[model samples]
Target chain A: MDFSQIIPSLPSLWDGMKLTLQLLLLAVAGGIALGTVLALARMSNSALLSGFAKAYVNYFRSIPLLLVITWFYLAVPMILNWITGEFVAVGAFTSCLVAFVMFEAAYYCEIVRAGIQSISKGQINAAYAVGMTYSQAMRLIILPQAFRKMTPLLLQQTIILFQDTSLVYAVGLIDFLNAARARGDIMGQSHEFLIFAGAVYFVISFGASSLVKRLQKRLAV
Target chain B: MNYNWDWNIFFKSTGIGSEIYLDWFVSGLGWTIAVALMAWIIALLLGSVLGVMRTLPGKVLPAIATAYVELFRNVPLLVQLFMWYFVVPDYLPEPLQIWFKQDLNPATSAYISVVVCLALFTAARVCEQVRTGIQALPRGQSAAALAVGFSIGQTYRHVLLPQAFRIIIPPLTSEFLNIFKNSSVASLIGLMELLAQTKQTAEFSANIFEAFTLATVIYFVLNMSLMTLMSLVEKKVRIPGMMGGAK
Candidate 1:
């Protein structure tokens, strides 16, 4: 009932929010870029390229995000040491960013693939008939249209990613949730701080989702 | 890397206990399945009701259902788990708070909170699926049922829901698979699920790669089996003239 503790904790919580936002924006950008390539590779005529992309998506999709985050957190340092022949300290932020981008690419790849598929086959044929190369057709004719169609879905996924950034706490990252918990521990009001954090998360996620819904409605027309 | 690989670490004794690392994995797998199955049952049951409410011919009921879905679906699963674990106990009345916080075993309490949190969170998603399924049904079906003297409840139970549920099998399969994957979050609250076991094994044996690799394989196998099983169910339940079953 006493939410008085949340006011004093706002400064630290704002720092945590910055980390969460940073992770969200970075992962969305990186994941979408990788996902677009994977979608192209998946739909390519070359069996090897398609198979690799398919396997990558399936592997990431089959497992939980928590395990992926943990794996990157634990294995990165060892992999770095093996490469350089000395121990290396890769921070939790870097590891989590790597994990989120890689894991989310699988999902984004599916979304992008669906988006690309939604474009009519005739459009690609027309692009090729005009002497455009495969890459050129995709880059100019197909992708622009697909990207427009996918904006709402991509934004919806970003909202999901924003919620998921809280999982970086697994690797001791000072995400908003972690920062709230830390402040809670020091202030002996863990429940109040947690409630505050949950309310904040709910507000952001719900508001973004509503915006995405409106955008979807407009796009449909 | 010049690091030595110990593939046999799963067979080695933990020294502090009689069990090997393999036993830890087996037990962890058991907990994972148990939590996922229990939570899935609750989510399905609760979500079905909420979904039906949203589709029913009333504003108040649908508004309530929408509110529930929006509230539960918006919050992250981890924060919800933390709230249930840390906050719910303090808000309970005096004797119940003591019972939850003190009288009950820590792991048991953690298990209960995780299951409840996950079920509520997932129920919101399931509600959407069910609502979509119900709404997707042709309006003629409801009208015909009503014209034939069927009550609203009877129409849903006999005519609407049966067809709607059949139509949504594919999406429902994905949701069912998600419950298993989402159950891994229980480890965050100290439930010692498969991921937690993997972390412990890595710490104990220092075979970080081996531990995670094995856990990943196990999860993959588990999901593959579920996918196969659900597909079989989907095939069996498919209505001949319906969406996926159409020739």
Candidate 2:
């Protein structure tokens, strides 16, 4: 409805764009790695590691992202203070990264577990017959194939992570939504700017979705 | 800066020093479940009807279905909440707000807001569900209803909706849980639900960890229970020979 107002705001949007990319990449990289470990832990022979993974995934997955961000933002500082005599140099970027990584870990764990579960027992038997250890076989043979197959899902997860990065605003991060709100405050127009912000989010999401689509189709041969 | 652990303060705050709203927390869980149940019913009935509408012969009906889905699904829930609680009342004449203020409990406003938001959002997904169910129904069932002199409405009421609901049970369960989580957002507009109680307890105790740990544990139990109950229901709904509604 207000095309004229939204058009000029692209430069300001670039700042948000950079922040979004930074948060998305950092969290997805870190989160996916943690998630892989958690998935393996959950599936491990050791009951302790498996139980710990189960609790972590169950706890993180069940809570709303907003509440998680709030708790981490507040609790981290106090926990730090309790540990040390004084405050640490932890910052907003660090805060956002910690919360997103933990939350996304739960989802990625599920996805990675699904990938692992899909691998046939026959393949593992074959590896075992060749005298390969479980860890060696998983790392050398099974995981590489699974990771390749799980790429589209990983991409989709990245998009969701990008969308969820906006929740960092609850913790006072100047992410895209926060920036848009800042502009809206100066311009005195909340609805239009909110729509603009939503559109920006949609663009990032849709782009990733389409890329995933193409990848899925390409892999179908 | 590595520091010493203060288990003393943590335990003192979480335990004896301040009151946690256990009664409020339990009642809040009840209220959350209640709102989710009522909203799920509304979503099921409304969504099924609209879903049926999208499949009916009229071009206009499908368009109406699309419009409903798009409008409700596109906006953020927070904006929708603000509009319902803050904007809608102002549009009504001052006398109406005065009447509502006098007569309706503040909690009713919160409930009404959750229902409207939940129904509107869930209906979109429900419409998709019903449409899939209808399309999946065997071709002769509707014809049999028609040949028996059952009106279109009668056909849907007896023959169609039941079958459709059965087909969509699994997805519908998740939708119920989805609405349950979404209800926590109602605390934003002062609904004192679980999360609201969490915030209130946090502020009162000055120990955020104690308050939030309690909240997280409660949420974990409630949600895990929901998953358990839903699986039981799913098992019960399985018509003995027909597993996962296979043809």
Candidate 3:
């Protein structure tokens, strides 16, 4: 509502954006790696590995992100301190990163599971016929193909993750959405806060959507 | 082997009985389920109408639909709720302002605002999914229905929605989970949902681990149960002929 005041507070907004970007990058990168492992484990032929992976994803996936973040940032450290020397509690950004990784990994595991499961089973057999080890067959044949189909799913998940960075605000991280709130507080203008923050989210999501379309085009799908 | 896990302290702070921490945890779980159920119902009803309208032939309607989706879909529900709770009230008429100030409780208003914001936001996603499901049906079914002189309403009722819902059930369940998870954001505005309760409990008991752990478990149980129910619904709605279309 107060343009004059908000314009001057852009630097604070930028700070929030920095936090948002770092959190997203960490969560997405870590989540994708952790998720891939979780996915493979879930899909593993070994019952123990599959059950472990399934439990990991199921437990994390079922919980809300805020609850998880609060737990890690608050509880885990307290428990650690109770036993021994002071624990290295993660900063707000890192706390969200860890929680989002666990949460997003659960989802990514499923996405990867769907993609991996959807691949024709006989492709592995065909790869095996060529004297490929199971690992070799998976690495060379099944996954590359699965990766193609996962493009859209991956894009969708990324967008959802981006939006979820907003939740990190509750943990006291000045994310993009949080920046808007700060702006509102400083300027006493909620409209400016929401409008700018909403625009930031929209840009990120729309950008991801376009990237997906580009990937589809390049893949000629 | 030096890791001494003190189960007793955690048990005392977090376990059952007149423990304030445990009360917060239980109440938090109750709030999460309450808001999710309330928001899901509103979204489903509103979204179904919009979804049905999307398929109807009208230039004006599609634009309206597009605008509706774009407005809600593009923004974070948190921001929407924030605006609804904080900014929108100021713009209301004078009597409405007095009513909001004197008659309405901020806490209840916050929940109602959250319900409205979450419902509209989620309804956009549901509308798209439903519309996709409905449209993905082979063109022939609707064509055949029309050939038999089935009215548009009749065709939608008898021929389209039933099959579309069958195909959309799996994704629909996922949306249900997503919305349920999202409702936690209402905590920011002092809606004492699960997440907020965790914060309050942790502050009071200084047992953040147990308090939040309980909330997390409750969320896990709630979502898992919801997922199971949804998948069951998915199975029940599995029409044999609709297999080819669903994702």
Q: CA shift at B28, candidate 3, in angstroms?
A: 3.2
**Candidate 3 chain B weakest lDDT stretch, 10 residues:** B1-10
Cα distance off (Å), candidate 2, residue B120:
2.4
Off by over 4 Å in 3: A79-84, A217-220, B1-22, B231-247
Residue B111's lDDT in candidate 1:
88
Residue-level lDDT tens digits of model 1 in B6-74: 989999997766999999999999999999999999999999999999999869999999999999988
Cα DockQ of the candidate 1 complex: 0.86
- Model 1 Cα lDDT, one tens digit per residue, A1-221: 67888887799999999999999999999999999999999999999999999999999999999999999999888888888898888899888999999999999999999999999999999999999999899999999999999999999989888999998888899999999999998998888889889999999999989999998999999
Top candidate (DockQ): 1
For candidate 1 chain B, the 10 contiguous residues with the lowest summed lDDT are B238-247
lDDT of 2 by residue, B1-247 (tens): 4333332432443353473356556667777777778888888889988899988987999999977865655444554554566546655788888766567899887778777777777888888888888888988999999999999999989998777777877777767767877777677667877777666666655656766777788777777888899878776666655644434
Better of 1 and 2 by TM-score: 1
True contacts kept of each: 0.85, 0.23, 0.67
Candidate 2 — which pairs collide? A83-B3, A83-B4, A84-B2, A84-B3
* CAPRI category for model 3: medium
Q: What is the DockQ of each candidate?
A: 0.86, 0.26, 0.51
Q: What is the lDDT of every predicted structure here?
A: 0.92, 0.76, 0.79
True-structure RMSD for candidate 1: 1.1
